[model samples]
Target: MEAPSFLDFIIHVTGLPGYLVFSWFMILVIISLALIVRSSLKLMPEGIQNVAESVVYGIYSFVEDILGKEETPKHFPLLATLAIVIFFYNIVELIPGFIPPTSNLNTTLSMALIVFLYYQFLGFKRHGIKYIKHFMGPVWWLVPLILPIEIIGHFARIVSLSVRLFGNIFGDDLLLAVVFFLAPWLVPLPVMALVLLAASIQAFIFFLLSTLYIADAINEAH
Candidate 1:
């Protein structure tokens, strides 16, 4: 018996060998980042400290843009946690002989499911049973048509979130595979750089879209 693997970067779907190596890579990367950030905490700003501070401030500004001031801090922890975890999972793909945890549908779908549960939960908290009214749309008569659309739309979010991440990372791994197959050394160097860029951007997109979905589920709709 073996662990499952989808989107084999090597052969067709038929091949997906030992993935525990990739899993361990993901864990180690996360622990190392945690340790580094933990030890680097400083009261006074230094050179790279200013850079880090600026990045954190920038993330806050971005969150405030999507969530507004009153509620921005409410979701900050969730947002930050998702961003950190996804980014770590993605960056781990860079290590030799490793696959990104996020590159798997199960892993990515789990994260998307988490987002789905959270928004639905919050909607219930905010609107109670009235949240169901959201699906009926503003016009009562339209509920018949709109209900299915809304339901499908919600499910689509989960699919989109998971697939988008899995597709990008898996494609990244595939592209690298090609590069390695062709030249195996310095040729894939450029691909590795592109992977880094794509990984970060994908993580950012995941965070931004998650914020939008949560906000939409509860917003007043001005």
Candidate 2:
């Protein structure tokens, strides 16, 4: 059997699921870091503050490029928050003795549902009742066929987002566990490097898909 992570050991002692506990721990850590970075911000922007600013600006630029300046300001918060949270959740698995929250289907699904629902809400908000036309086909006669297909396709986004994140993270974690068990030394180093790359890519892909979904929702064109 694979060894229990540090949080898993805590589960044995505390009788709570380690993933749930560690998720809360990670949330607190992210919040604390945000506060510290905010408090230490300077006119010149050095150290952690500078790094944070760079990340935020990079995301902002990406969002603006896709969403345009007017829409970017309105949706940037949700997009930025999703990117940061997902990235942190993904990379947490790289730390020994901790299970990444993203590795859990529950966590990924919850985030996926959030993105799905939020964009749906934005669609209705932006276009009101006319948003139903998005589901309907280009021609009035095709409503029955197109509506179902569009609805199913929209729902599938939730599955796509959640499964992709969970599968990648969980698979990477399992691979690392097996590698460490067999070699327990230098052999795992390269695997760790690959995992790190996968983690970053998965996070960015999630963010990109989310932006596309939101764009589709608010799009004026049918």
Candidate 1 differs from the real structure by a C-alpha RMSD in angstroms, to one decimal, of: 5.5
Q: What value does the lDDT take at residue 54 in candidate 1?
A: 80
| Sequence-dependent TM-score of model 2 | 0.93
lDDT of 1 by residue, 1-222 (tens): 122243233334434443434555556766786567667878887665666568668878888998899888988878877887788788876765566778788778988999999999988888888888877777889889999999999999999999999899888877776777777767546778889999999999999999998888787532
Error of 1 at 117 (Å): 0.4
lDDT of 2 by residue, 62-160 (tens): 999999999999999999998998888888877777789899999999999999999999999999999999999799999989999999999999999
Worst 10 residues of 2 by lDDT: 1-10
lDDT against true structure, model 1:
0.79
Local accuracy by lDDT, each model: 0.79, 0.89
